[model samples]
Target: MNALLDLDQLRTFIAIAETGSFTKAAEQVNKTQSAVSMQMRRLEERVGQTIFVRDGRQSRVTDTGLRLLDYARRMLSLNAETIAAFSSDAMSGKVRLGLPDDYAPRLLPTVLASFATTHPNIEIEVVCEQSSCIHRRIQDGRLDLGIVTHGNRTQERNGRIIRSEPLLWVSSAHHSVHCQATIPLALGTKTCTWRAAATEALSKAGKKYRIAYVSSSAAAHTGAVMAGLAISVLPESALTSDMRVLGEREGFPEMKHCDIALLRSENARDRIHNALAAHIVNALDNVSGGAALAAE
Candidate 1:
């Protein structure tokens, strides 16, 4: 039998599977696209299995690939733990993390789990709030790090962007809210990024809309839409099966992309902060991929 799979190859495989594209996988792994393709071909040859099924411009993992993905994650995790255990400076510090309430449910579990495993001695203090509030806390030095949704497309010097997804108009599948002459909206608080973007898009398109329901909670906005009270604007990642996305065909204006950014304080140079930030980025990647699958 061939020797055990190379760790680097396994890492590359995982990246391709998670990212859903070879170009994206190359970016994640810091390899050329051709190199990544070569690695995948080599991996398949060694395993004697076809892992990914290629479509026109997309690739889907085969059943065999899905099974291998589970093992790949476990192996990489254990490899990381084993290396960290022997390292002289084992991470041992408390980290203050701020996240938006809307993202907590979808992103927290994977981040916390992976960080805890790698840095068992590090204690994570998480605060769930709105993105604007989290940005304020980070700027005030009250938080060591935070994940926020920024309305602007330009990158900030103090923040790193994890991903950017479209802000979309969504309504209840059971409602004809989109057809109303004056659109009724279920929006967030005045400080909410999505609310501001939605209104700006509507105004630019000469569309008339009314804020029919206002709440600070994502659940509340979703509930309002489900109750057919109003249509809501939300990030693509926040969409669910029951929500119908309204596009140009439905007369909805195009909205700007929301950037999911990681903000770090001056103390970000510390090992603990760096480790946590990496974990957060990795977790968000998985969450984004899952959200894409869910939307499909």
Candidate 2:
């Protein structure tokens, strides 16, 4: 009796459970629909349980499949921690990194420059994109590592956080958020952490706001607010520049701190990622020293 549940098959089942459709899961796992179905079948045979109840339009996990998914997530998470723990020694390589616009301008330069100065042998490739895009790329294995904002303390994705920064609402020189006839809003794309929080807070507070400006880049989002187009919420780190605070009412929901994480492949134990992660954590920890040096 084949009793050991296959890890790959379990992962596929988890994806299907999350998506609730085999087509979506197939795309997510980078397998053909038929291949994905075959893997699930084999997994069911090995476990001797019907994991999914499939209909023509949709599929849902049986109680057994749901139970298996919880274990699968833990297995993958532990599998990551195990790698990061042991694979602390290796040569750094061409490290491709993705960062959000605000982070790229604020903390990332110091982090990268320090890493470069320390390990001159490893070449660094950097891309500045929205945090949402960064997470997607990391999951797709298109990049080696990434730094993204954790809007919800989102650990579901395979990312290991290195630094966390608070998110706050900010506006132009003398303006604060007010429940006037209309509150002006400055926002990033739909995927941005700050944008969503700012809007949601307004709605929950029973205030009205119109997006005066929306940009894909966080820098542009902040820039719009600085230009007095509207109010916006952002990580304090994004306020690296001199700007006056406006209507910051205390006790507004604290947006999950912007988390700069090392979003790598399942191979968190991979030598290059481990080295880069260490270098990043160390550099971010020395925030004052690096900021001062960056000033020079």
Candidate 3:
């Protein structure tokens, strides 16, 4: 008999699939391209199935590869948990975190759960507000860390970008607000990046639009769009299954990609903050469909 799938090989396989290029995967895993290729070949042999289809400069994961990817992710997650659980540095302290209402629901639960499991002694306090509010809280030293959206045009930089997704025009699947002569828009307050990007794009396209509804809450924006009151611009990650995306064919202008970043206060130098930040980054990377950018 032979050993089961190697953890290193599985990690490499995931990196390749996530990065979409052997060269990129090599860079990520700190291996030479030839070494990455050797690992893939060895993994394919161990599984007794063809994992990827290679052509010229491209490689596509096969159906078998997709199936293996699921198992690989699970294995790696468990492996990470085991390592974190036994690490000598047991973290304990109160960490205050803030996030935009739109992203909190989608990302906070999983990130907090993972952190809690690994650091049982740590206490986490979360505040969900508008991104602008979160930024201010961090600046005021009212929060230890924050996850906020950075506008494409904002010259002031404060954090590492962990995720980037396209800003999209979304409407109710059952409504035709997009077809209206003057587009009705549901937007957040003036400080919201999505609102600014949406209006700027519309204005540049010479399209006429009116703000039909304004709310700082993500729920309000979603509800307005779902009720056929207006279309709203949102990050692709924030969109729900029930929403329909409007594109150029629907007479909507293209908007810039929204960059979600992590900011830590200058005073947050404790082990708890570092542990929680790592967990948040890993959790987001897992859900970001391999589009999660390396923190910079």
Candidate 4:
């Protein structure tokens, strides 16, 4: 007979992969380090596959582990949903959620609506800010959860990657601004990862550019781009019909992929928090090639 895959072991495995530290995973799952290791060993035995390999001091997930992750998440989500549907005790509490305005327009509707329908008793307080601000709030215990852009090393250390998208050089479809001798740019504040990527790409390509507008708001970037004031770098989802992507043929270098991640506060361990986070992961994980004018 085939061995059964235990839900509890899969839960521990997820914590380890997301936290990227055995000790941290142990803490998150309420298990001792030795117990966590023992559970992983049993999990490997059941599956007959090596899922983890040591990298320096960290245990990195193997390719097989990565393949298993999607199924694990789906299974856990369904299990939680099923339990919540029939449980005598319904979950209720306030969850402080944070994310940039860029994502709010697109991601907020779906995630909020779904969560509200299933966990009606729960209240959610949302904060819209830049990725840096969201990370600070998560670390400071002011926010229960955050969906943030992956760029800062400090933030990435504790972040669980949820999605990735291409970063493209975008210009107004009706404008020839990208062909200017000194390219005009509309970008986020100096601290923004997208801005850093855009400037670095231009500098490396030996292209001259000027910062024409600076704002942390995606709407502001849209305004600048639509008015033929400047070109900007945005995630593929953030592009609108009025915008066209620029590339190497247009003298723009290819930018790096943008990673979106979920960050949870240390104090958020209750059932309500877990439910909301899981709901968010499930909702966002299924979004692919969605056409939206939202930002990171």
Number of the predicted model whose lDDT against the real structure is largest: 4
TM per candidate comes to: 0.78, 0.60, 0.70, 0.68
**Which of candidates 3 and 4 is the stronger one according to TM-score?**
3
Pick the winner on lDDT between candidates 3 and 4.
4
Rank the models by lDDT, top first: 4, 3, 1, 2
Identify the superior model by lDDT, candidate 2 or candidate 3.
3
Error of 1 at 259 (Å): 3.6
lDDT per residue (tens digit) for residues 1-296 in model 3:
27598999998888777655677678767899889999999999999999987555456788899999889877877776677678777566799999988887778655675466456668889999988788788888999999988755453286888888898999999988888889999999988888888998999998999998999998998999999999998888777778999999988887888888998898998878888888777556555333222321
Best by TM-score: 1
Predicted candidate 1 versus true structure: per-residue lDDT over 145-167, tens digit per residue: 99888655333445788978888
**lDDT (tens digit, per residue) of candidate 2 on 87-199:** 65525568778877777775665567545534545677888887778777777877777777665645435566677766676766655543347877778877777677777
Task: Show the lowest summed lDDT stretch of 10 residues, model 4.
Answer: 287-296
> In candidate 4, which residue ranges exceed 4 Å CA deviation?
1-88, 288-296
Cα lDDT listed for each candidate = 0.79, 0.66, 0.81, 0.83
Question: Model 3 clash pairs?
Answer: none
Quote the lDDT for 87 in model 2: 69
Global local distance difference test of model 2: 0.66
Sort by TM-score, top down from the best: 1, 3, 4, 2
Q: Candidate 1, after superposition: displacement of residue 223 in Å?
A: 3.8
lDDT of 4 by residue, 1-296 (tens): 29888988998887666545666667667899899889989988988899887655545678888887767766776776777778879897899999998788768865775567467678999999999999999999999999988896765678998888899999999989999999999999988988999999999999999999999998899899999999998888777788999999998999999999999999999999999999887667544332111110
